[model samples]
Target chain A: MLRDITIGQYFPGQSPIHKMDPRMKIIATLLYIVMLFVASHPLSLIVGIAMLVLMYRVSGIPMKMITKSLKPVVPIIIFTSVLNIFFVSGDPLFQFGFIEITRQGLMLAILMSVRILCLIAGSSLLTYTTSPIELTDAIEILLNPLKKVKVPVHELSMMMTIALRFIPTLIEETDKIMNAQKARGADMESGGLMQRAKALVPILVPLFVSSFRRADELAMAMECRCYRGGDGRTRMKQLHYSHRDWIALCIMLVSIAAVLLLNRILA
Target chain B: MAVIKTENLSHVYSEGTPFVKTAIDNISIEIEEGQMIGVIGHTGSGKSTLIQHFNGLLQPTSGKIYIDGEDMWADKSKLRDIRFKVGLVFQYPEYQLFEETCYKDIAFGPKNMGLDEGEIDRRVREAAAFVSLSEEQLMKSPFELSGGQKRRVAIAGVLAMKPKVLILDEPTAGLDPKGRDRILGQIKEYHQEEKNTVLIVSHSMEDVAKFAQKVLVMNRSKVFLYDSVENVFARAGELSQIGLAVPQITQVFMELKKRGYPVNSNVYTIEAAKKEMIRLLEKGGEVRA
Candidate 1:
């Protein structure tokens, strides 16, 4: 059941999105986030949503996976939308008991929800297209200028890559540990809140111990391989910005500029 | 009556996703009470998946599991009782130890059963004794124990529940030869003394040949062969083709049989091979040494 978690999950494909440069994908995701916030008008929001739908289709990733990624943030989405409805004041559209529903408030709520949805969908698309290793390489390269100020950019990326790589491994280990405890008659399913929290002790303790053991072994293995971090490391597959990457960047920039123009004109 | 029976059992992992895989397919088997059964298979052959179904640890995608002639899933509320009745000791069970003291760790299972303190205490000591753990060791923290001792404590934790059928998945994995023998010996002794059904999932043909009366061989998520140990080893060629090596001694006997000796190729254990060799030598038969 825990396997249903799709955070940091990558879907392999040969679509144009997948073939784009990782650095461009990261930058495009950032641009998309900015566009979602900038597009306050309905027309611009429609454009943003359409762009997301187009990317979702072109990426060739399963639609179900994109929806699944939003499942975890459902509560947050509802919270923000409810706040928008109650907090935003304008001409009243309707009134029931103590709750006044304003036209502007209603519109703001819908806009906020759509923006959040687009934000998540756009970022999830980037992760779906780029592998974790590639994402780390892009981050390191993007942060390369910080190296002049004595920042350990390569080490930071290495840590990120290792953490991403071990996520599945740690999840599998947790599953095993939980099963082993359950087999010994630990009632984890039905209990009061405190009782349930106590039940996690068996799972968490073992999981923590095993993770430490795994980290120790990983460090030893890295040392044996003569891994010296961040110093004079060369790339096997050098990152190159292709024509597709330039086209993707151009499209994102144009869309962002259009949203800005529409927002100003509508205002 | 069979202690455990699976009818057309099948499990598909990550169903409805691109990662979907059929772990076990249409597996049907009946296990009698008090039988020592060993499960052997190549990696990902569904040996672990099959045993997990016996205790209701996993719900079959489409199938039925009957324990003591009753559908295990008949009452969802009773699944907890099923787990206590069919204890499973997982691979590297030592990592599951959490309680401060070994004694308390062993008591974890019995305590979950809601047994009285005296009853829990009795079962805890009894389980510890069954695994040959000393009283002093039981008082020590489980983390302080050696690797083998920690494993023993983990096994004792399951034994404290006094399950009617015990299923151990790769119990001897990652252990030294002596440690493996010790744990297997304790399991055999427990099965004999309690007369409870035991199923051991292992990759070691020699370990299974030495202890298990019956063997269940799985290949590609299907039961390739399930029969007496002698019978299973007799079909050594088929087993080897499926990436399972017969016991080392069995291979030696097969070599002897090929060299014109009147030997039983069905011999799986050294003791059995020795008896067969003595019988041939005593008959005054012309044998090439």
Candidate 2:
């Protein structure tokens, strides 16, 4: 059941997005997020959605995957949208007993929902296309300048990479521990909240113990290989910005400029 | 009545994903009561998957599982009770030890069954005794024990539940020869005293040959053979074809028979091979007077 988590999971493929430089993908995702918030007009939102649709098609990730990523955030979307509709004051559109949905409030709610959906889908696309190793390497390279200020950029990135690498391993361990406990008749399901939480003791204790053992062994293995920080470390697969990255950057700039221009003219 | 039965049981992992795999396929078998069955197969031959279904740790993608003639999934709420009825000690079970003391660790299962304090204590002590865990060792934290002792504690945890059917997956894996024999010996003793069904999934054919009354061979996610140990090991050729070999003693006897010696090639254990060797010598008219 834990395997169903689709968020932050890499989807291996040879699609253009998958082949794009990880650094470029990261920049593109951030720019897209910024553009979504900056755009005020519906026409700009349409343009943003259109670009997203085209990117999704080209990435070759199935529609089902994007929908799966969206499933978990449904509650958040509804909660925020409802709050916006009732809390934002404007021309009254629907009113009932000290509760009202205003014209501006309804419009804001719709926009917020769309923005939230697009934000998740766009970011999820980046993760789906970029492998975790490449993502971490790109972050380290991009943040290299922070080292001038005595920031431990390399160490932080190394930590991130190791943590990301161990997610699946830890997940497998948890699955094994859960099954072992369940075989002992641990009732994880069915029970009051407290009872259910109490049932997790058998699973959690074992998992934590195994995790510590794994961490200790991993550290020893790393030390045996003479790994000492990231000083003078060289990557086997070096990052290169190809012509496609330039084209992608140009498209992103043009879209943001167009969105801003249209918003100003329409306003 | 068969203590455990599966009707065309099949398990396909990650079913709807691109990584879909059929771990077990169309396996139908009825394990009789009071039988010690050894499950043997190459890695990924579905040996682990099959035993997991018996205890409801895994639900078959397609098929029915019955624990003592009652459909396991017929009532979802009773699955926990079913799990207690079919105890499973997973591979590297010692890693599941988490209690402050070995006694509490063994008591975890019985406590989960909602047994009274006295009953839980009694079962814990009995299970510990079955595994030969000393009173002092029981008070020590399970984390403080050696790998073999931790393994015994984990197995004791399941035994304390007093399940009708006990299934152990590679219980002796990664243990020294002495540790292996000790654990398997205790399991054999427990089976004899309780007369409960025991299924031991093992890679070592010798261990199974010495203890199992019956053998179940799996090949490519299907039951290759399920019969008496003699019958299963008799087809040494077919067994080897699937990357599994009969006990070494059985192989030696087969070679002896092939060398034109008037020897029965059916011996699978060391003791049986010794008896066969003495019988062959007596038949040769070489008796020392």
Per-model TM-score (chain A alone):
0.96, 0.97
> What's the TM-score of each model vs. the native?
0.97, 0.96
**Model 2: CAPRI class:** medium
Model 1 chain A lDDT-worst window of ten: A38-47
A44-132 in candidate 1: lDDT tens per residue?
79879989889999998888877898888899989988988877889988888878888888888898888888888789888888999
Write down the TM-score for model 1. 0.97
Query: Residue B253 in candidate 2 has what lDDT?
Result: 82
Per-residue lDDT tens digits for candidate 1, residues B1-289, read: 9999999999999997778899999999999999999999999999999988989889999989999999999899999999999999998899999988999999999999999999999999999998999999999998899999999999999999999999999999988999999999999999999999999999999999999999999999999999999888888899889889999988988898898788778887788888998998887847754
DockQ, candidate 2, vs. native dimer: 0.76
Candidate 2 Cα lDDT to native: 0.91
**DockQ of all models, two decimals each:** 0.87, 0.76
**iRMSD per model?**
0.8, 1.0
lDDT measured at residue A115 in model 2 versus the true structure, 0 to 100: 91
Model 2 lDDT per residue over A88-108, tens place = 998998889999989888888
lDDT of each: 0.91, 0.91
User: Compared with the true structure, what per-residue lDDT tens digits does model 2 show for residues B133-225?
Assistant: 999999999999999999999999999999888999999999999999999999999999999999999999999999999999999999999
